[model samples]
Target: MNAIPPAVQPPVNDEIDLAALFHSLWEQKLLIALVTLLVGLLAAAYAFLATPEYQVQSMLRPAAIKDLDALNRTGVYELTPEQAMQRVGASLESYDSRLAYFRANPGLFEALRQPNRSLEQTFESFNREAFKMLQPDPKKIDSLSAYVGIQLTYPADVNGVTLVNGLVEHAIQAEREKIAADLQTVIQNRLNQLELKMAAARANYEASKDARIAELLEADSLKRAQLQDELKALRQQLKDRRDNRITQLDEAIRIAKALGIGKPTTPSALGEGERVAQGSVIRTEVNNQQIPLYFMGSEALEAERNALLQRRSDDFTEPRIAEIAKELQLLAHNRQVEVLNQRENEDLFLKDLAIWREEATRLRNLSVDVTELKLVSVDQVAVDPLRPVKPKKALILALGVVLGGMLGLFIALLRNGLRRGASRHHSDQSSLSS
Candidate 1:
């Protein structure tokens, strides 16, 4: 097919030659060593010159039930150990609390000061990184109890142990004060409420007493009026009886004078024979008629009328009149109303007085010293660390050497590749020129 171009063949160099690559790398060993040495020295300088940081940690656990018993006993508030621990954790995590502690105790963080930064800036930096709250991982199955920790990473020169411990104590003290204040507020509010109730109760009692006084006065007025009316009726009845008696006496006296009889005489006082005769006659004439009042004789009737007319009062004439007079005299005063008005301790008569006084006393006497309260338990206090935690010199040195060797190797390979490409290009150009 035009001599078929004899099946032109392509270059076959798919496999890399290990020996040639080794030789090329060996040729550039001095440059590789120089690069590696420079990187290693830099790593060493950084490792040695960097300041060391120390870590101090404190562990907190829930307080015992007995430790929180005092606060729980005050029925106004209740606090559990876990809640206390949570409060302490929140305080520990507060930036303001940390800043306050730092400002109040400047000497504690003096070593962290720097010439290029203000005290506030330095504290900000320290607050950002130095403090850490450590908690157990929720995913871990081995975590049985709730625990909280405060870890402080500070420079070697700073007293991390004192700083961490002081921070923990300060948080606890702050929580205590807060709890105390809350308790005081609760007790005060209760006292105020009790006072209001007591005042209301007293007012109601006074109102009731006044109402009772009014009721008694009204009843007394009614009773006195009734008694006075009854007394007046009794006196009129007595006068009417006396006046009628006088009229009957005058009629009897006129009958006695007309018949010429002066003294009281019974038919029986006459001779027996004459009395029998008169009785038979009267029996035949009078069936059931009573003897005439004139038979009582005018003298006796006149004497009775005179006695009734001369009487000063009708109180003795009827027993009920005397009783009515006594009752009227008693009603005039209303002893019950007088007693109620004169009562000095009206509250003592109130139904809930004892209960109100007892509650008020209990609230007023409710005093708790938060300083004595054990809000949390420090399972582990921060201790002075024996060694620094930062600037892991050994690991840094090892990494530096490894990275340096790898970078050096990469540079060597790049240079060798460039050289080989340049040589191949030159050969191809020479061939084209020939």
Candidate 2:
């Protein structure tokens, strides 16, 4: 019973004074009201005046430079993801190559690398301003990122939309022009090489024209004169031999007619006429001698004597063999020279034409490849942007209001504790004086 009375009489030291808290809040009512009102006004103003900019985001799947012919050949309709990635990498090479000031011009690479004072100054100025704005904004331009499309937060206003659209169009045009210009450069280089070759040929022609012409004409004239002389000699020998053969033939024919044994009749037709008008007299003589020898040796003696006149004369009587042999030798020499000249002319003409055709083909193939790249483009349309299904305003505001009220209540309690301690100190002094 004593412990219970003492427990009832003992004062609690740690108990929070709710009345003091209420009094402090009542005293600081204006300040609390002001703070609450200010917070509410700020929140409302932010909710109303702050323009919510919608970031229009749509995905872009990279469209590879596909060959319709590949489908026709393989019958496969689509590329695997790996194959698509490979194509994306290849296309990225253009971007990387042009990444140095957008493929400004020839010698641009060297110029960019070189540390010129003016260029360094320009770069410094650009980087200082660019560091804040540039911030790797892929969506600001039609940048390729793993074949994905992303647009950064931008105002849905007309100027913002126009800026994005213009950048995209500019990037596309730049890519196309870069491809075309590269083609033109390659073509121009080949053309220049061809022009150089042509110039060299023309120069060579000019330098050696007189000498070449003189050499060709002189060689041809000398060959023609020599061949003509040999042909004339051959003709003379041919004529002399022909005349001797004709004389021998005539003698044989006359003797054959006298002897009545020009040719024996064939077994198929016993009554057919003898064939003797155009045959070599020597052949006819040999046949007649052989035939006569079988019958009687003395009968072929006249035929042998008649055929001897057709023999190529080695003596001074006609000199027909000697003349024909010399003529044949001269004709052979002239033909060799003529063949050489003809072969040389044909080889020279063919070689130059082949070189010209090869050069033309190289230039044509390069131009074709360039043309193919220019035709690839963005084949997509923009639809309305999708709404973000996050951060509902009413819920966030309610949460913020609750959190603010709790914080205000804690601060009020802290003030109340300090005031209660001051009150206790005043009471202790009053008790000591009594």
What TM-score would every model get versus the actual structure? 0.78, 0.42
Best by lDDT: 1
| Candidate 1 residue pairs in backbone clash | none
Residue 295, model 2: Cα distance from true site in angstroms:
55
As a whole number from 0 to 100, the lDDT of residue 96 in candidate 2 is: 42
Please report the TM-score between candidate 2 and the true structure: 0.42
Candidate 2 vs. truth: CA RMSD? Answer: 16.5
In model 1, where do residues sit more than 4 Å from their true spots? Answer: 1-15, 114-119, 227-323, 355-369
lDDT of 2: 0.47
lDDT of 2 by residue, 207-265 (tens): 56546656665776776667667656666776677667556555655555565553442
> What lDDT tens digits, residue by residue, belong to model 1 across residues 147-255?
9999999887788888899999999999999999999999889889888988998889888888888888888888888888988998899878777877888887777
